[model samples]
Target: MKKVRIFLVLAITSLIAFTSCNQSKPVKTIENLKAGIIGETTASKKYEAFAQKAKEEGHDAIAMLFSAASNAEAVHAANHTKVLESLGEKMDDFTPEFEVKTTAENLQAAIEGESYEVATMYPQFLADAKAEKVQKAEQSFTWALDTEKKHNDFYSNALSALNAESESGLPTGYAVCPVCGNTYDMANVDDKCAFCMTDKSKFINFD
Candidate 1:
């Protein structure tokens, strides 16, 4: 009887340890998701301010690009929030603080922000989600990471055009996938989003 009790106690202890190990991963993933939410939310608000600045400066085409990218960032924040909720975590309310500057300076700022996400923030979040086996979080991070890279390149090209005073403006239009925030130059849009496979027809177009 004593041996039986000992065996049962050992089994229960092992099960508890296994459950704890599993629980720790989800906690870590939830924290990563929350951080992603903050990053994306800040991007959304900053881009909106940047769009207004561009409009005020008469860079209408660049303003439209910023507007589309702002919407895409909001979509990314929503996706991250959804993942957090799925993990049984509540998302904290966030209000982003940003400075508004000249169109050229704002463009530079946007480029820097996107570069950080591509090179540092999202990469670390992606690794965390992957290690935790949180597929939804991983997907959200991947989508944001890829879109930020594109945003960086777009901002770079726009800055170049602005500096050169080129009559040939940036792309005629921008389209954003509502599902995954994958942005495309309207001139070269695919039938489906390269990242999320969302139908191009469903993309939110900024013209």
Candidate 2:
């Protein structure tokens, strides 16, 4: 009788542990929802700054497209902010620094930033939406992906035009990786520091 009672106790304890492991956390809380909204808003502001700079530099076409994108981003951010506010959570301000030396540099930075966001950040956002069962979040991410793709194409065309007009008829001051012997094309190259993978500053920049 003693042995049987001990066995029963162990069985109950094991069952409880298994049940706890199988249970999933609650879905679609205000905290996570607010985070998603804030991220999108931050991205919108970054693009807005980039668009303004491009206009200052006379890249009118690129500037116009980016300006349109900024509007779209603002709409997305505001929608999310409204939802979060209804839940009694205040959205944080989002402002990002813009750093591009020239018109070409701005285009390159915009393309690289967009590509990274689409490939890396958007996927994670989609996964979170799926986990939370938030259909709106998924839709928002889809739209962002499409917009980034268009931005990529626009930058590609602009770079080609710039390359064609240079006096030497070639890209200026661009260096090649001695190890990879790859010509630096700012629009497409990985931002990884090729040598040590520490900082992009380590990589040689070709004008």
Candidate 2 accuracy as TM-score = 0.55
Candidate 1 per-residue C-alpha lDDT over 58-137 given as tens digits, one digit per residue, 9 for 90 to 100:
99889988999999999999999998888778987767888999999999999988988889988888887888899998
Q: Write the per-residue lDDT of candidate 2 for residues 1-207, one digit (tens) a residue.
A: 999999999999999999998765424445555665665566567667776776787666555555555555565566556555654567666555455467677667767876886688767766877777666556556555555565566567666776666323322233323222223334445565343233444444433
TM-score of each: 0.90, 0.55
In candidate 1, how many Å is residue 188 off? 0.7
Report the error of model 1 at residue 31, Å.
2.2
* List of clashing residue pairs for candidate 2: 173-206, 173-207, 174-206, 174-207
Report the C-alpha displacement of residue 97, candidate 2, in angstroms.
Answer: 2.7
